[model samples]
Target: MAKKKRFLKMKIATLIMIAVMLVITGCSQSSGTSVKDGSNESKSSSGTLKIGFILSQTGTFAPLSEGIINGFKLYLEKHDGMLGGKKVEIKVEDDEANPQVALRKYRQLIHSEKVDILVGPISSSVVYALRDEVEKDKIVLIDANAAGDDLSWSKKSDYVYRISFSNWQNGSSAAKYLANNVGKTAVVLAPDYPAGKEVLRAFKDAFEAAGGKVVKELYPKLNTNDFAPYLQQASAENPDLIYAFFTGSDGIRFVTQYKEFGLKGQIPLAGTLEFGDELITQPAGEAAEGIITGINYSPYLDNELNKQFVQAYEEKYGKLPNIFSVQGYDSAAIIDKAVTEAGSANSEDLIKVLKGISFDSPRGPITIDPATNNPIQNFYIAKNKLKDGGIVPEVIETVENVTMPETSPFE
Candidate 1:
């Protein structure tokens, strides 16, 4: 009996040792990587702030993610790789522009990584998916790009603050200007998505309020191979102008095809900022010329901060920064400012500091509206002009202090 007992004890001790080794090995293999450089520096140190980014690093939204990350890194480089005097560590996850994938990544960032703050997502769908989760987790999320209107309205949360413009702002910014200067009868078009529907609704409301009539509304399925059918419908309606909102490859195809259909000159083309932004206009080339848009940021803006930002961005990335880039830069700026003011990285403190925060951005002076946690800023009515063989937004009129309503129109 004594000999049997000794053998059983030895076997139990050996099994325990193997279990400990397995756990240590698993932890060692799962270390987080730095976003700036793909280095395994995951261990947290005192005075370190962990920021997790959920972005679409693949698929159609890759360019947007690239711009955002580049702009953010530039801010960190300028600030000695610190935010609010705390050393920063970042972890990025790609969502492929899918809401389900974004939610899974969000869980990893929150539960496993234990990130202090969150930022990112190019698509509004991703934003909507992460919204409830962030609120439940009580984590602060700086909305970098998603522009769904409801975010500032019925779905607004204390844990979330948007650093980028909303779809309501994008849609209504140029409505009055176009109605008064361009034409009274218009046909509106956008991709058939939540963003597209919300933007057009806002535009229709504001345009009609400004004594303009929307004679037709067309929504093409996102990533449509050919825009011929939609173009034919718009042409048949024969409105005075066509106002559109399409981004990524869809924007490129629509612009080129609009010109192909010979509707470019016959019917004026106006849209949200994407139509005039380099992302679309560069590829669209001459096809993007004469396109009028409501833009929040342009590399050509004559502002001191914008000038310096443009110079530095071009030096670092070798390209002119777009609206998305500015959004990312502002995201970093807001976090820095909020953390400094709050004097703590806790979500409770950050939330208090984020509300109604104002800062001079590469875009312009931006103030977060306390009521909705949306930006109150300027919008420019710009026309795409080919200057020196490059398309640029030439500001024609400035709409200053554009603000969202205290209550959602939907409500």
Candidate 2:
């Protein structure tokens, strides 16, 4: 009887030891830490909520993406590196401005990294390519920069949201400005893509609606470096004004070539807000003066919020915040608001909160359209001016708050 009791006690002791070992193993996994039985030492564990950022960090969209990332980081820093009381981890993947690469990186971010949220791929093509994949994964994708109208209209998805103004929105305002203010006989040039096509269409529709005419239209290849031929064609057209939609370095090249061809003052130039900011203003110097563009946000915007944002941005980056930066910053703010309102980090909950959510922006109050998941906001008409030997864009007029027209083809 004594021997049997002793054996039973030993068995119970062994079972307790095994149970403790199992608990330790489980804790290691849940805590995101590795443990080694041989060392008999437990390492401190840390938890992070991973956020995937896919952008053109090294390619054509680099300049824009860099601004987006900077704005996002600035918001994260202001929030003290925590979102909804969870430590935030930003994992960056360079798409190199290629749609295929962006798609691959997105898959990796979802399947491999298991990120909680995903943002970016600054090119419209990249955004379109991965939209389906992001929907399938049920992840929230906040587009900070891409402005293709199709994403907000025909290809709209519940999971995808855009904080920036669409190319069509800018195009519509540009058309209004040209028809009502500048008056008819305009030559239009944009890249051969959905965004460019949509901008041209909006401009034409609005211009013609206002009793104006598009004298000539040109579609340039996205990578074309030479604008000489295009400029010569535009000059031959002898339109009252020249309207363009080139972005990034292409914008610089186009305007520089326009000056070279002596079309600068002979014919006034106007375009989407992409051309109005520091990117073109500072770099193009005197050449950017007198150019008009439609904008969503300007550092010179007369709002208390904008005033603070511009001051903080200049103090940190030593430059004025561009539209991209404002959009990116607002994107982070929207996400933060959604997370707080939802009271959870769950993607679906956050998404529900995001729908119809409105926030005060540098551009003004912007609301996410439930049907399209895009922002409905105001557009600005601005002119580039040479101030203090630096090119600065001053807002000439506010076009007032314009919503997406019901007749918009994409819708």
Candidate 3:
């Protein structure tokens, strides 16, 4: 009986010891730890900067997302796979241009992967959905392509900063130039979505303010397979010009159908940046020719920085870089700059450094407006002219230092 009791006690002691050892091992494998010197500073276990991208890799926004990812990877390739002088680990999730899917990916990125920075989603709808979540999670999101105007206004969050142009900038940038050069009366068209509505509204306000009139406004459902009906409606209006905003496959189809419907030369076709970008023009071919647009970046820009960028991009990808590509490249550039300046990957540290950050971009010198958290950059009034067997934007006029207002002009 005495030997049995002693053996049982020894077994219990061994089990307890094993349990304590397992707990210690688990703690050592945990995410991070605070400084032992009584300071509140915390550090990650691996000391690697982790970035998560939620992009539309398999939907309408795929091309745009591809450009963004390509540009980001190019930057990494040039910098030895590092950002802010620290090695970067990137995890990309396909949001499929859907908001709910983006939310789920966001959770995985934040909780499971523990990424330090967040980027992307080509859809403005997805950006709107992510705005609240990033704020709640206290993660810094660098907006690569979503351009909804409300992101800089009513729905703005300190946690979110846009590297792409806003709908307001997109719509209004060419309004005055087109109103003066193209015609005084125009028909405006965009898909019936938040970005579409905001863009048309901006164009309308600016065009009217510049003494021009919008004769009619057309809102077609997104991804309209045929723009023949809208083209007919705009043609029937007999306006001086037609201004439209469409992107991705929609942009390609609209430009092609606009020419097929015989409204290309009869009524001047003017549109936002996407109309002038190579993504649409290369595929649309002759149909995209002679269109006037307001563009933020083009491979044809005359500058040493842009020339180098074009050469490097072509050498690597065997293709020309578009505005979406510039947005992606600048997205990585801003992160590298911010992280370096902040000296920490924490959201709090990055936010402080990102405000009013300025850098020389392939587009031109770009500054983040401290007030609106939107980019203050240049807009080019360009006309698509065929050269070298391809359509390229010919700069007609340069609008410099185009800035977004701190408050919504609509409000």
Candidate 4:
């Protein structure tokens, strides 16, 4: 009887040991599976948040585009490559600064590459070409640099939003400054296109309304590198100031030659969208000094966020942040905010969250237009000044935020 009882006890002890081992092994396997699943989930989430960056990496807008890309990358890195807990991935494409190429690239990004968000194409013409496609796909497009008024007015859509202020706003602000502070007689020079026409009209309207006179207006070709002949004509006119609107390399050429021809100081200069960081301050050298231009951003903005951004950008690129950089940084911030508020990357959710949304940007507070998906932001009246052995444009005055007309003629 004692031996039988001892045998039963030994059997029960063995069964209990087997059960304990099984539980331990099961717990180990479950933990491993959980870790694996979590990593997979992270990868999957990261895969879903693909961002498409289309810019003119090799053409007329290269300098501005490079600045913009740097700003975007800096923001992502600062945030540790994650926004709202989703890993961020940027797919860059060069548009070659051509509208046709930009169209194809944009289509590929939307249909084939399947990017969740679209970020850029510096040229307004390029953006105009792809506006329809962007609207059709219902993909949100944050314009980082293009500031043509039509993008926000005539070609407006729910999916399109601009972080940059419109050319009209800049023109208006500049016109007001020239009319009120500077002399009245002015000569206007811009590219021969809709953008040029719009800026000229906006400036003329505002200046004339302020009891100023536009002495002469000239529309030059977009890619014209030689501005001597035109500058001579404007110089002959002897206006109190010249409101020039050339961009890219042409801007540098215009300012440099304007100085070479001894037009500096004799006739003060003012314009919209001409004096960006890449062209006016750096490449134009001392010639860019004292040239007043209207812009939405300046490196010397008195804001904490902007200061940090400029510092990080200078550390990385060894250059001051341009308007394009400011706009691009704002674009990322806007998208991040919308994504966080919506709690999803769905188009509808993003659109709902972005409409009329406002956020602090390097250029001060920026708000989106609910009707046209445009940005409502303040414009700056800046003058180029030499600082730190480099030309640094400083904003001498801040222009009040100008809202677009409720009913634009283009719209």
Tell me, by TM-score, which candidate is best.
3
Question: Model 2 residue 24 lDDT?
Answer: 100
Q: Of the candidates numbered 2 and 4, which has the greater TM-score value?
A: 2
- After superposition, candidate 1 runs with Cα above 4 Å error: 1-45
lDDT values for all models: 0.89, 0.79, 0.90, 0.78
Candidate 3 lDDT, tens digit per residue, 184-260? 99999999988899899999999999989999999999879988888889999899999999999999999999989
> Model 1: which ten-residue window has the lowest total lDDT?
33-42
Q: Return whichever of 2 and 3 wins on TM-score.
A: 3
Please give the ranking of all candidate structures by lDDT, highest first, separated by commas: 3, 1, 2, 4
lDDT of each residue in 1-411, candidate 4, tens digit only:
999999999999999999999999998754432213112111223334678888999856787787778888888888888665578878889998778999888877765666678898787787888788877767778888777787876678778888876777767877877888888889999889767787888889889889899989998888787888898899899888898887778788888888998999899987775664545668888888888887777777789988998899989888778877777777778878888888776566788988899998887888888876777888778887788888766877877766877567533
CA-only RMSD, every prediction: 5.6, 5.6, 3.2, 8.8
- Pairs that collide in candidate 3 are none
Q: Which stretches of candidate 3 lie above 4 Å from their native place?
A: 1-19, 33-45
Candidate 1, 1-411: lDDT as tens digits? 999999999999999999999999887656442211212133333578889999999866788888889899989999999998889999999999899999999989887887878998889998999999988878889999999888888899999899988999999999999999989999999999999998999899999999999999999988887999999999898788899999888889999999999998899999998897878988899999999999999999999999999999999999999888888899899999998998877777788889999999988899999999999999999999988998988999999999988886755
TM-score of each: 0.89, 0.89, 0.94, 0.86
Off by over 4 Å in 2: 1-48
| Clashing residue pairs in candidate 2 (N, C-alpha, C atoms within 3 angstroms) | none
lDDT computed for candidate 1: 0.89
Model 2 lDDT tens row, 1-411: 999999999999999999999999998675442213211011111335567899888845678887887777777877898666657788899998888888889878776666777778688888999888877767788888887777877778878888887777878886877788885889899988777888888888888889889988899988789988888898898788889998888888887888878888899999988888777667777888889888887788889989988888888799888877887788778878887788655566777798899989978999888877778888878888888897777887777656765335633
Task: Evaluate model 4: give its lDDT.
Answer: 0.78
Which ten contiguous residues of candidate 4 have the minimum total lDDT? Answer: 35-44
